[model samples]
Target chain A: MQTLSFQFSAGQPAQGRALVGCVGSGDLEVMLEPGTSGTLAIEVVTSVNGSDARWQQLFQRMFSEQQMPALNISIHDFGATPGVVRLRLEQAMEALADD
Target chain B: MNDRLDQTRQQHYQAHDLLWGFAPEHLPLNAPAWVVEALQVEPPVVVRRAQGTAGTIAVGVRGKTRDQRFACWMPRSAVSHSVQPEQLIEPGLAQAHRDWPLFKALALLAEPLDQSGLRWGVTGSLGFQLASGIEVIHPASDLDLLLRTPQPISREQAKAWLELIAQAPARVDVQLQCPAGAVALAEWATSRSQVLLKTQVEPLLVDDPWAVEHVAP
Candidate 1:
């Protein structure tokens, strides 16, 4: 297993914490909590090693296009495909909005 | 099909069929070393639901480890023998494996499955062992099953099926092969929003897997 962290500039902290997806089902599980007012942080625990660059690129590609609230995100990844990772992140963010 | 003259019509090979006589030479030139070495044993490849070229069928070669699977296409003509998952579990075909937790789960599922009358079949390690007698199943092996669903079943029906499957001694995973793709039976039963539909090319989280058109990404 490998753990990687990333930080991004962000808007105000999200109003509430939220969790989405399930780790045991071969999908990425994501948990989001309000973070420092101006920073977004993500910690990923992945079963696949040597995927640091992919995660970096994925997060950069995602965050560059849209602005998001400052939140601490914890991801438990079970070798999920990039699509699954993206979907779970979106799902977690949406769950936070629904909270 | 009786009046059909199209010779190139693709032959139907469902997911989980064990196909024999696939030549290693047909594999891509840059195939992984492990894939080439695994084929040296001449194991029957398992048919996958992925789409392939007109004359080829998508198949996966299994190696020793969980990460050793390699997907490739094999010409239809290269398939000399085919055994469907249901065929492997025919009453007299399987050697007695009752002591195995996997088999115990299958035994527990038999009566309800038969009574339900859904077109279901075995798959995964247990099916592999039964088909080839390779004994790949371990003590902790989960019983994997495929439920063929040309017509979408109600969520209530899927929930019922899940409850029945949950009674097994071991964990069970059931995939519902809808007309378009496959979805986990558990997700279809339980998910409040969209469920993940596994198509040949990609997985799409869709509200209805049985829909006619998918917004392919």
Candidate 2:
């Protein structure tokens, strides 16, 4: 498995933790926890290699403009496509927003 | 030509079916090294679902590991041999590797699965191996199954099947084949609202997969 790290600038820290998705074929599991002030840290452990740039592009597309709360996100990915990754990320963001 | 495959008159290929006789030099110009090598190894490429193009069908090449799968399009006319999960069911049970978790689980579930009366069979790694004798299954490889459920099954029925599947030595992933598309048995049994429906074009989140009308492209 390959582990990728990405950090994004953010707003205030989130209050509660949220988990979404699963480590299944063509899917992923994302866990969200409140992190240090003004920084969103993400670690992705993925089964697919040579996907660092794809993840980078996806994250940029997702979080480029929107300022989400500071959270530490850990994703356990099992060869999910970018579409699936985006879907799970959106779900995680929604869950965090609900809390 | 021993290609008496049980397919529709339209020759609609479903995901996870294995197809042979593709031109290896037919990949996109920028195809990766591993993909080229894997195709040269001459394994039957697994059929994949994607938006339909005029003459090309979507397929994936398995490169010995879960991480080594590559999705690409193949010319439909290039398919010399095709094998579906239905045809592999017998061979999967007849294979002598019951000591392996995947085969063992298949053996354990065969009777009950037959009794359930669901048009079910093997797919994924185990099915690939059984069909081609290429040895794609490992000890931890999941037993992927497809239950052709044109009629929507009750959540209770899905739960019951889940319980039965849980008894197997291997992890079983059963995709319920609705008229529209497919959904995971675990999700359909447990989800309160929408579940993911994997269609040929894309995955759709629908309350009832069977209720959705499949639109052919």
Candidate 3:
């Protein structure tokens, strides 16, 4: 598995934690938890190895585009397509927002 | 013989007898032969559904490629054993209550369903992790559930149940198992014209849950 971490300084910390999706075939799960630090941290563990650059680019694009708060977002991936990953991330964030 | 077998058709089996297998179509490994070899080396795939016939039963297998699910007929004689989902989950939940805070929380959240008289079982990563002692669950794993009900669930009732689960720390995916078939609570909540119902025979997009039936091959 490949692990990647990122930090963003866009939005304020979310009120609570939330999660979405399951780590199954062509799918990925995302978890957003309250972060003690002021930074928004994202850590992705994926089965697809040697695609660090591609993943980094994707994460950069997502974080840059979205107004995510200061929370720790962790993803467990099982070779999910980019579309699925993005949907899960958005759902997780939406859940967190609702919380 | 048909009557006796019909009685056993949809009956749930104990977890010890069941051997989880991967679907031939989705087997990720390049070598299909290796999977066949592994099946010989591993336990024989057990029957998931007893179709009340001489040759076959609906067998459960996971997709190798994507998270697609597969349940199809296989010769009953080929199965070495059967497994119960409830048996695998209850022990794990009990153990987790003593140690894991997250699981403890989930247990508490699930209490209402038990009180509601719904037969429920956990099935996703948490279930797999607890049953196999595998490290599948992370800090953020969703509490996937299977709820068995003898009768159809109303849309309003489904929403109410979902509201109860939404209070949990993690997201919950509940599949309501009615006599006709099992449908995801989330999908059912949409109140769509048709919902995907997974039955012992096969999955179908059915509007009326009661009218759906699984015919043995």
Docking class of 3: incorrect
DockQ of each: 0.29, 0.48, 0.04
**Candidates' C-alpha lDDT:** 0.78, 0.80, 0.60
Better of 1 and 3 by DockQ: 1
Q: Candidates' TM-scores?
A: 0.80, 0.90, 0.52
Could you say which candidate leads in TM-score?
2
Candidate numbers, best TM-score first, in rank order: 2, 1, 3
**Using DockQ as the measure, which candidate wins?**
2
Tens digits of per-residue lDDT, candidate 2, B79-133, equal: 8989889887884345566688878788888888788787887888888888888
lDDT of 1 by residue, B1-217 (tens): 5323222243367778899987779899988898888777778899875667667888988777654667889898898888887676575656666687778888888777777776788888778777877767788877888878888789999899889777778888788878767788888888776777777667677888888453222
Candidate 2's residue-wise lDDT over A18-98, tens digit each? Answer: 776643577778899999999999999988877889898989888987888899999999777787777777777777777
* Per-residue accuracy of model 3 over B90-189 as CA lDDT, tens digit each: 6444454344544755666666876888677766556555555535466665676778777778888888887777676677777777776666686676
